[model samples]
Target: MVKHTKKAVLLTLLTVNMIVVSACSTANTSNQSSAAPTNDAKATAGATGEKVTLTYGGWKLDTITEVIKAFQASHPNIEVKAENTPYKQYFTKLETSAQGGTMPDVLLMNGPNFIKYADNGMLKDITGNIKADQLDLNNFPASLVSLYSLNGKNYGIPKDYDTIGLWYNKKLFDEKGVAYPDASWDWNKLVEAAKKLTDTSKGIYGFAAPMMNQEDYYNTILQAGGNVISDDHKKSGYDQPEAIEGLKFLTDLIQVHKVSPTLAQMTETAPADMFTSGKLAMYFDGSWAAFTINQNQDMKNNADVAVLPKGKKQGVVIHGLGNVISANTKHPKEAWEFVKFLASKEAAEIAAKQGGAIPAYKGSETAWLSAFPQYHAKAFIDMTAYASPYPVSKNTSVWNTYETDILKNAWTGEKSVADAAKELGAKMNQALAAEK
Candidate 1:
């Protein structure tokens, strides 16, 4: 899920504080314009056995520590230093590093921020490298490949992908005598089950309706046959009736159905915390959350996953992270070699076995599903049949900020769904216009 408020603020800071290199700029953007590394550059890099140290930046470095160790073992000529930062402060720190011309040689790029960096000539156009190496783009999901691409040029290689699913507690369902959610379940069934399962007296809510985007409202919006942005990526869809209907679905759970905790209540205790603590009977989360959810001993035997209940139709949001090389890197060839390994089947297999996230590599999901036998983990992959890419644009954070601020009104009942969504559409349109 996109943490709209914090990330949006950092993105704005990045655009303001860092030097914005034009896509066509020749001064500091030579890396961006270069089609491929010169043969001499490659000869002096890892291929020639020259020792090189490259900084790799990302949040949650612990998750890929094993992968990094494996890369170092295979490529003894290159040493990768891990620069770990919390996700909350990741972009802020990246911006600071970019300003100092100390950006990591290789870094993680999420869908929302990928275009921004590419547009500013901060990321190397890896199209030439990919073609030179004959790395099959077909090895990953098309959505992810496109996510990190701009104008027929690829800038990043997918590391992994995540899709949303409905996570529920079997113990709670059994106690309430509610049947487990399944593929056939729809909006009405979810509401009925939630009503039966809710027990305010016991401080347990039947469902979690937090003010979240990717994990909550975004899926609902898509399920209602609505969209967050237009197909052309130039307009907002929030003002559409279908979009309003989707937002209303979640708000009604809190306001009309009273089966969910209010936004304020959820603020006091995060819905994920509630789920792990057995206070929330049902919640929606991403496939990346599998490890964290299973970490709770109490939930190990009590929880399982299912496809999200359909609204007007079945839908879910799909997103992934990619490994991008910095345009200012001193070791372009070495960085590409490391990035190649990161996107290779070996790395994907390690990721699957280690269980940080679902590997985006085509044929590696079986290992991931086998990694966790406690829950029906396949439900995460199953939803990909109807999953839509998480909405993005060059300035996704600007409109995301508008979404976070404006949608709070509807979630709080301060404004009607129609009013909040309509207002948000107008604000988002202004931001979209500025992108031009």
Candidate 2:
């Protein structure tokens, strides 16, 4: 899940108070913006004692700490030393270490960041170690595990998944005297809802756009029967008339519909906060926001989740976390043990209990649903019926680097949706070609 801790708490307990809990995967975030971590923080301390410390690196220090403690308690031989870095720089840091051959033993990997490490051969292929019978393969959802595999090699274990949904503010809709969205929602209904719900007098917006990949634009693109990338993961499809049409629907909400906040405004103000504060009627956010929104006092009883508005097709992006080991590691065998334990049903179960996130294991969703039953948190499971994989990219950075800035112009009135998408298609093809 999204990782944030109010403060650090150290438990000096003598023994593990095993609570039959599940292990949850944590999300790594960036704090240094574009800069790398300080030299001291990245310094490797080799073999500090008789105890074998398997250096682990992640952005989510809290989640990693918990998992490492629990694992160390059981396996006294291995001590997992976790280093937390911001998400943006983690890969950059890893790349630097990889060149110097000092990469951590265990690491966290994500899809958008995958192509770089996997393509560079910096990641260890654990497909054989994670075979169905040996690891808790049955605990994982097929869709999640498949995200980490390339050319028959598995780089990581499935951690958790997050998917997009329609988060609406009942307070805003109720005040506007408009009905909230449901299964029958269509583009027309969304437009009508936005128009009715928007009240400029109250300093409230109808919606907000953050120029995101999965939950924001891509999800809308798929709902309109358009693919961001072609099925084979080759060629860019943004130039397609269908894709442009799909995009216009969201951008139009601000440029034409005038019911949503513009790109400039959203850049200054976070959209989720605006929604939780009852400034927006609806937000296209992931199930991960269930806790973030519900925790807000203003939105606790006011917010609810629902299926996304449908276009010609029904779609939602299914994104998951994976456990990746480094190619250059001092403890390959011990790292494999950690990977196997991480891939177990028991680990996923502990995570669920700790509000870790929606477990990659199929049936483990019930605990995540239990984590926030009041917000109808089962929306993750329900949305899965219509979920689509995040459009894959072999050279992901080629597209990701240019995506936000290119799409932002369309999101504002600066570029027409069709025109901008056509230009993006050409640039995307160039990006795809550059990799070869």
Candidate 3:
């Protein structure tokens, strides 16, 4: 997701500055008043013992609506107002609301953007709130819990998690007389299978390496024994020899081996579309795709999932969404209560039954696995043992943009992999330096 920036207007020293200051104050007050619950409203709810309405801002309209209904069923005194936005626009809306002190009472937070919001004091500090409400942090994986925390302060509760996996078209494998992927398959085994599966005359390719981070190169980087950023978040690891080797492996698939679609080819057709259309044999994608894939008759009958093939070691990238309350919310008590319920096992089960992304709460995955009995859903849950948390630092979007833009040159064969990595490493380090 992209970060949103608001345009600033220049003002003169005396008259213009006075007018601009007054205008901003008036606008901010007006926005906050309209966006949040009023003091009189809260008092009325308290005095009359009536239901209190809390606005929830997030993506995933269907799943969130289901979950909210469930919450309302149990908590009759609270009503949730969902302000759904597309993933692409969610952050932009959030950034604008936050600037105006008009953010919703609660919102979904992704790992890559969590630090930016938490650091800026946009999120409520829920460390004490969680304990006071008796919410079980033990229910979530330690890795995910750590992912949403900054400097010992917890700003969010893990909602759902996802991991990368290898998705293959069984029809193509059967046609070619090849076995399906399994734990025994390694990077070399995958390449061999891709070679046998590719049939140019039929307009089918074995795989697609689209220079994507989460489902593609990030896992490869970790499996190849390379890190994206230093553990301290103080340095970039792209220039390391192991990191370059990881990147080269992907570029080789597109430019050298010819078993995967070229960057140009994937540009014309998304890898997911190609796989679903039977134009690709094998693809790498997230577990979240299972919901849509299961709904496709052809895919449900002909496709299955497996653990991502190992490189030097078995690895995959894992990321999750966190539900957080707004620091500026007028009703902290009501918001905290809602956030607490949202993190509970009951809420997670609602998400699982709807086939939303894998619920982060332990043992809740069984419900999700059962939601799609036709596919190998267990592969995603099992991958957590060897998974690496999705890489991020403060201001991840800044360096992430650099990573994607510079690496495209290598993916397109316009620059050598090593040269591109070297340039990216320098530029990324520069961005990292500016974070603090």
Candidate 4:
């Protein structure tokens, strides 16, 4: 999960400004010639005792001040300068830097945009770096490591991971005389509870059916035995019956059941805001929002999380950011050094204790769970048993445009879900075909 502050903005950017990066080869090793550093590359680029400065670009740099200070204390020869851009503008800034040949030495990269940057010859191939240093790839979740890998070559070190969970307000449930959700809950139970909890007179909704993907519909699609992209990555699954059924479930909540906030209502105020304000009984969001949501005085004592309700089967989407080196960086060795430390247990521990996103480093999650003792945060980790990778393609940005444009009608109740899904599938298919 990119920071929650950037979710709506990033979603818009994906449809608007995300363009095909370059006409470069799509091979996993395409960047090796110019971007990958040789095995015998020196540890430092300058004189034996000189220092190297690395520019680290990411959203919310202030969250990791302690980690950066600790990194420099250990690697005294490397000075890290953080380039903190607001989450909404971070990717746009990165694109400008890549186009102008001034990408930061080290930067944070997300799963959806990873293939675009890797295929366009903008990111360093770090497979050799991992091999030469013998960094244990096992430290991170295999799914995340694979997400950052292209064809068998690793390009990034996964920094952290996040999964979606059901966030319910205990006070609201108690007030409505509704039982709290749990692992045993299924789609039928969720609907029954939602109907009971909804109160139109109080402007209170039972659930939130936003037009978002990762945090909302994608999980349901998987649970309904559907895929967003096909196994071979060449076709769209939106036109399939399973996918349409999954989508219709949410649309019906707004149009027929009248238990959820409409797209327009959620647009005026985010679902997360409604949840914290005690105007919603149940909401779905990523683990990345835990800390920020807990900051609400009322919610801090009244809310907790549970596994998402099962549909045909249980499923959730997993996504995370990785740290990658810029192909154009003059200091590959120093950049790799900085990246390696960022993936280390020490740094992961710092992030976990701060209640940041879930650390990808194995065994480090305990600290993160301890940071939020009031809630059942471990439900997020438990969901990993049935988690699916966030969907992507070589030209994901192209198809992303199709999803937003075609699906908005279904979300607004202006078009039937079946019709909207079918249109989206056809357009997405054409976009995927263009990548070949």
Task: TM-score each candidate.
Answer: 0.89, 0.83, 0.87, 0.89
Mind giving the per-residue lDDT tens digits that candidate 1 earns over 96-188? 766556788899878777777787667888898899899999988787788889988999998888888889999999998999999999999
In candidate 1, position 119 carries an lDDT of 72
Ten-residue region with minimum lDDT total, candidate 2: 6-15
**Regions of model 4 farther than 4 Å from truth:** 1-47
lDDT of 3 by residue, 1-436 (tens): 1112211211011111111000000012224335444331355363456778888888775775787888788778888898888776676666656556567888888887777667655577888877776777989877788888988989999889888889999999999999999989999999999999999999999888888888788888888999898876779989998789888888888888898888888988999999999999998898878877888877877999999998899888788888888766766677777888888888888888886778899888888898778888799888988777777776776777788799999998899999999999999999889877
The sequence of per-residue lDDT tens digits that candidate 2 reaches over residues 1-436 is: 1222210110111011111101111111122112222221232332233566887777765654556677888878788888888765665665455544566778777766565456545567776666633665656656666667776677888878888888898878888788978878987898888888888898787777567777788888888988888755668989997788788888888878888888887888878878877788887888778878768887888888888888987877788778888665545667777877777677777777777768777776776787676676676677766676666665575576677668878877787888889989999988777655
Which residue runs of candidate 2 sit more than 4 Å off their true CA positions?
1-51, 136-138, 392-394
Candidate number of the best lDDT = 1
State how far residue 266 of model 3 sits from its true place (Å): 0.8
Worst 10 contiguous positions by lDDT, candidate 3: 17-26
Clashes of each: 0, 11, 0, 0
The lowest-lDDT stretch of 10 consecutive residues in candidate 4 is 21-30
What is the Cα-based TM-score of model 2?
Answer: 0.83
How accurate locally, in lDDT, is each candidate? 0.83, 0.70, 0.78, 0.81
Superposed Cα deviation of residue 286, candidate 2 (Å): 2.0
Listed per candidate, the RMSD to the true structure in angstroms reads 6.0, 10.7, 6.9, 6.6
**What is the TM-score ranking, best to worst?**
1, 4, 3, 2
